[model samples]
Target chain A: MTVQARSLVQITAPRQTGPTLLDRMRRSSLLMAILAPLAILIVWECLTRVGLLDQRFFPAPSSIIVSLFALVESGRVFIDAAWTIGRMLVGFVFGAVPGIVFGIMLGLSPTVRAFLQPVIAALYPVPKIALFPLIMMIFGIGEASKWAIVAIAVFFQVFYSTLAGVVNIDRIYLDVASNFKATRWQLCRTIAIPGALPFIFTGCQLGIGMALVIVVIAENFGTQVGLGYLIWQSWQVFEVRDMFVYLLMVSLLGYGSQMAILRLQRAVIPWKKDDAG
Target chain B: MSSDPSTTLDRTGLSPPAFPKIRVRGLGKRFQVGKAWVEAIKAIDLDVQAGEFICIVGPSGCGKTTLLRILADLEAPTEGEVTIEQSDPSNPLSSMIFQESSILPWMSIRRNVAYGLELRGVPAAEIDKSVDRFLALTGLDRFADAYPHQLSGGMKQRASVARAFANNPEILLMDEPFAALDEQNKALLQEELLRIWSETRKTVIFITHSIDEALVLGDRVIVMSRRPGRLKTEFKIDFPRPRRVYDLKANPEFGRIGREIWTLLREEVVGP
Candidate 1:
């Protein structure tokens, strides 16, 4: 009977050890995500070393890294990155804050929505980058014009997203507020703003990316301090390695900004569970 | 049908006031659905005594919710008026509890409970005390800091109830508050509601479709007919106070009253 009981215990409870390989892999998924790019870099380095690709156009990964390091050490990278980031942030703030405010107004008042809808429809579809010449005429071919271009690009994105956000708030919440005798201001403060937060974060994410893109395009003309100017200068001189370095920096900056925005969203709106995970 | 004077007097305590807590005179509601106007309710007249628990029961789409909404001042009646007699100038006339979860999703359970008091500009210390009291009463003290999304459906509804009670409204208007809860949770909430109602003695106007629920909770059960709803019948339930919801249903008197209401309700449900 004792022997039978021991066998049953073994069947009921398997001997415990540690996490399985799959569990460990899942835990270190971020490392696996980095591994793919590292493997690609290694293969590209091997291919270049073997002389399978021409060195003139496609420089080795090691040489590109060396160029990157030299660019950073020269202090030019900081100036260019600062210029780009500053332009994006200044333009983004000016554009997005007003956009969100006006969006909320339009969403809450049907009269305002009706009055602005036609004008918004007319202006929203026109590519904001294409307005750079007109903006240059008004603000001059300086930082003002670049800021205008970036701001216009970001404004429409944020405005539309915020409007959609406020408009989509469940009517039930408003009714509940009304039942509690909430004033108009109280309704906006307590119900409307918090309810529309998720969508506003989405708008911010989109607006930032658009601001980055417009800044690059704006810098391509009459700008010398930004990463866009560096890329343009490199391409003009046919320095492919330097151009690639700038491109990589731009990509990294975009990725980093997006991740930062996502982190902010997670922190501010912890109630929104990420079901995708 | 109008309320009986003797029952209203008994519920309102000694030296009953000249006016009822709520007086509805020819209350009617019509909605403009698409192009045509749909009559949701027609000429509802009700006089609810102070400290009375009244349950309004009807078939689906019979405008019981519309009537409750009108009483809570959430909706304007197409015709007629609702007058709430507020004795205290400082207190709000009414607070509503919806059928679905109405606790603010972004707010913690404690914040949601404290919201009404905050809106009323109550002192911070008083708000915190009332919030704590109601949270403990509803058995949600442990989840005070948790967001609504982190709570179960029943707990969220409990938070909603606690919020209304903490506001200390003169009248509580509930529209099928437990309609979405399961049988077990419904029983638990019903008991909690009874306990709270007995202690507070605030005038309650509850709307529900369940006959058993109406019999278990209401001092008087008001039945209404189909769309363009009108009062069909009223049953004065005299179930003793400090009632156990679970045991109430098993009582033979509970079944007899429930069946009588159901019989009156069946004709309205079946048409003509």
Candidate 2:
């Protein structure tokens, strides 16, 4: 049979109506976000005041916010955050660029992959922090050492994800490419890079997460200008409130950076199924 | 329209061609499942003239796909020789419209349609012209800027068809491109495909399990046996040109041919 003629669009736009409760909440997502954290902080502050929690270890949230503001006013938070973020970005750029480059190379060529896979496999399992002392021996305890540790830590995550992404691209797509008689260079440019991009972003996200962990630990050793330095410094001086403030800043950085990456992923790969706006 | 199979040769050129457009002799594929060699297809011989629409129909897992792949140069046949006579050096040898999810999801409809041409490094102006024409022809012009994820399954396959046509390859190889669609979509696409194909009679090798689809689309419907497939029967469909699928099936001869194919295939499908 044949001659079936009609529209292809299965999904029609829903009828618009007055804003429901769910719609209202979705519209005020930013407001909702602020309210939940603020309410939690207020409850914690009240609990501290009532002596329900130990004031020594668990300072009032209000006092911590005050210290946070004071730290901001003194520009200490900015300096520390700037240092930490700067190192993370530098390390991320160096590590991620090479990781993706090598990922594409190894994914495409089995000869090189077979030769180097064992080396990569053996090296990836070792804790990155354990390599820091070895890194310090080479770069010394300074910005170079911090940068090296962060970059090295991030490289593994990005490389693994990029490799997996490229290798696991649907066979049909590659078959399509091959039918068109694409050159190896054309294959990489047209298919491998774009196809592996979603996975590369996944790697970058994990890389950034690890970057934060490594940066804080590396700062604990050599630098006095980062959030990690402030954290360790606060512990030594017993400035519990300052410790809470800096620790809060660390968490904010982690959350903020992850959100920034998600935003970047949305911008870069707007065609991702669930991620499409 | 010449219904004669002999007249199908050399439609592109004024003079008759010295050779067939495609030559496949004793083609066989063996897949290794663990340590054992699994015979996917065995000792297949086929010849397709230029500008001919040939459809191969068989039961599922009959290795028709593997045969199509070998012709497309995506897979190598272990036993025999396969050659595509490329008349023009500039045009690609073959372009395949896959069963599903063949079009790149990351690209917009326009870009996906233009992908093959872009890979071949054709001039941008020519690429744009062909792409625009095929997009509109496929009813995807309105959604030229839309990505594959935004389109329906049928629409995505339409884009894949558009891509193959836009590339203007010498031979078109399709592996059950409509197998994933619903009946309505399948009919619609079938009509559209026949219309497009009539306009440009590129040598086409279509593989499908649907006997009706084969009869409706092809000048010759080839039937193959089960796994480790070998060609069993060949029927020349002498339906006159511009035959619509809806009207053609109503003919008593159409039922006769379909039943003949079903009978030939039943033994292979039912075992012994």
Who wins the DockQ comparison? 2
Q: Score the docking of each candidate (DockQ).
A: 0.62, 0.65
Cα displacement (angstroms), candidate 1, residue A232, comes to 1.0
lDDT of 1 by residue, B228-256 (tens): 99988999999898888878888999988
TM-score for chain A, candidates 1 onward in order: 0.88, 0.87
- Lowest lDDT block of 10, candidate 1 chain B: B5-14
lDDT of each: 0.87, 0.89
Clashing pairs in 1: none
Residue-level error in angstroms, candidate 2, position A25: 6.6
Error at A199, model 2, angstroms = 2.0
Q: How well does candidate 1 reproduce the true complex, by DockQ?
A: 0.62
Candidate 1 residues A227-273, lDDT tens each? 88888889889998988899898888888887888888888887775
Per-residue accuracy of model 2 over A111-160 as CA lDDT, tens digit each: 98999889989999999999999999999998888888899889999999
What CA root-mean-square deviation does each model show from the true structure? Answer: 5.6, 7.5
